[model samples]
Target: MQRKITPYLLVLPLTLFLGIFTYFPILSSLDLSFREWDFMSSDKPFVGLENYALLLSSRDFWNSLNVTAIFALVSVPLRLCLALMISSYLVREGIVSRLLRGALFLPSVTSAVSIAVVFSWVFSTDYGLVNGILAAVGLPRVSWMQDPQLALGVLIAVNTWKQLGYDVVIYIAALQAVPRELYDAAAVDGGRRWHVFRRVTFPLVMPTTYFLLIVSVIEAFQVFTIVDVMTRGGPAGATDVLVNMLFRIGFSLFDVGTGSALAVLLFIFLIVLALVKAHVLGRRVHYEA
Candidate 1:
């Protein structure tokens, strides 16, 4: 009996932790989404889809959805492409390469708020480093964060800078794990570098790329702190991503039930997107490599 119980005992702590923190919250959110209540209210009246109805009809919600979609679609590809190329170069073992990887990855470990704060100054219209360089070059100062046309672009740049490090590190690991024997074989057959990479390296790295795609998409949707710190989804609501709107509704406006409904919708949207990704990309991932 002792031997049989040992495995269950070992797993019990983790199970309990998840139950308390993860599973319970998800269940609570689901329940809350169907009811109307403020955070302080004792009475949570069952509204039964009213929150969802409002969200689905709201123009702000749709705008947020569009902005989030654009952000994810644009940023994910840019980050992944740059990370892949950088990792390709940095994959070789050397002191300089290691140092560069550490430098690049510093941003990933740093606080998001800290990064946002620094970038706010960097992109500031007057005293910013970017504008200073523009002045030096005799170019007109551009409103990076203040212009409605440019605010989302600024956020995208900041986000890309912050996330590049982690993606590069993961990509480096994936590139390194690629069997060296395969490269040697390709070289023996006189495979050109670009051709060899296209035929072999790219295919082998598909699994990593697929995983990063899913994670990065989710990150893009949840990009609240940087937006809040930098633009507060402003310059005429041009940068109002979904999570920012959700936070505004839930906490800032103190609309608990509506916010929960929005959260639930976001959750469901991500789940459907993930399922679509798996269906489309899963077969292309080469686990063996």
Candidate 2:
């Protein structure tokens, strides 16, 4: 009995820490989502699911959800494809490959806020480098930030540029792990480049691809700094994301209950997305020894 109790005592601190630090906060947020209480006010009113209903009925919430969905759908595939292509090229043995890989990965180590600031200047209407180059080639100057449609696209492009490097590194690692013997066997079989990739390389890399897909989706939903720094949810709430909406409600409008409800809803949506992806795509992932 003492031996069993001693092992339990060893893990008790960690269990208690997780309960206090992680589970407690989550439970508290869920509880808060069902109540009406401004952080500054003394009286707390029980609202049940009223906050969730309010957000679901609000046009702004739906609009932000649409914007977030568009951003995720557009950015993730482009970023992953570019990363896979670049990583594939870099994985080939050569002096230039090493140099190029290092260069490509530099952006991943840089601060996002700094990147956003630089991109803002580059996309600036009056004196941005992009406009200057377009003008040099005899083209019209477009307002990237001020235009509602263009603002979200600009943010998407910026995010893709910043994130692609990390994805490239991930793909590169997976590519390196693929056996050279498989490529040799494909060569012996007179396999074309596409055939080799389709039959041997891609199948083995599916696990990494699935992992990146889920993580990219999750990160895309939490995108805030780029929107905050570049457009501030834009000219007409065009770039407003659910997280950004939650921020506006909680910090700007001071609607604590509504904000908590939004957070809960976002959390639920992400969980459902992750579970669906795992259920649907998990079987598709191939693990190689």
Candidate 3:
């Protein structure tokens, strides 16, 4: 009894902290989603799923979700693949490898808002460096942010570039853990570089790939700073993601109930995805240790 009590006592502070902070806020948000509130109102009217109904019926919500899905689908795989390939290549080379690795990893450690600001200028339709280069080459200047079709792609590219560094670091670590003996055996069998990577390295790195995929999905669902700072969900809401839409509903429009509904939906969606990922993939990690 004393041993069990001691363990419970040790965790009491953490339990209390979570109850006050995490659990309370989640419960509050859940309750808030079913009611109507203007953020400063003394009285919150109980609306009973009206906010959720409105969001479900609204075209904006669907559009934002579609944009978010596209952004995540395009950015996550490209970023992870590029990172894995570049990191693996770098770890096999000499002095240039070290220099390039450091350069590539810098963006992940930098501020996202600042990076978005710089990209905003770089991607500007008029007088931007990208358009300037196109003009110099006698190509027509592309309206990057102004065009609805191109805006989401530009935002996806920015997200990929910003997140590439961290993925590279993760891939580098995974590549280093791969044994030299495996490579030697592959070479002795007359295997080319591509063959060795496909047979040995990729299989060994499957666990890391799964991890990056799950994390990228979660991160993609929470994207807001870039959309808010760069495009403001402009060009007819082309780049509006779920989080940005939530902010617009909750804060900008002062409709807490609708915002909370979106938040709850996003939270539940991510939670389900995370659980499925863990249950399905957690059992499949290749361990050589």
Which sections of candidate 3 miss by over 4 Å? 1-18, 276-284
Error of 2 at 88 (Å): 0.4
In model 2, which regions exceed 4 Å deviation? 1-21
Q: Which candidate number has the best lDDT?
A: 1
TM-score top scorer: 1
- Which has the higher TM-score value, candidate number 1 or candidate number 3? 1
Model 1: residues with Cα > 4 Å off, grouped in runs: none
Question: How many clashes show up in model 1?
Answer: 0
Q: What is the TM-score of each candidate against the true structure?
A: 0.98, 0.93, 0.92
Clashing pairs in 1: none
- Taking the tens digit of each residue's C-alpha lDDT, what string does model 2 give over 1-289? 9997999999999999999999998888888899998789987789999999999999999999999999999999999999988898898878998888788888777888999999999999999999999999999998999999799999999999888888998999999999899999999999999999899988899999999999999999999988888888978999998888999998898888899999889999999999999999999897865
| Local accuracy of candidate 1 as per-residue lDDT tens digits, 1-289 | 9999999999999999999999999999999999988899899999999999999999999999999999999999999999999999999999999999999999988999999999999999989999999999999999999898889988998899889999999999999998999999999999999998999999989999999999999999999999999999998889999999989998999898999999999999999999999999988888981
> Counting only residues 3 or more apart in sequence or on different chains, how many pairs clash (N, Cα, C under 3 Å) in candidate 3?
0
- Candidate 1: what lDDT? 0.94
User: Candidate 1: how large is its RMSD?
Assistant: 1.0
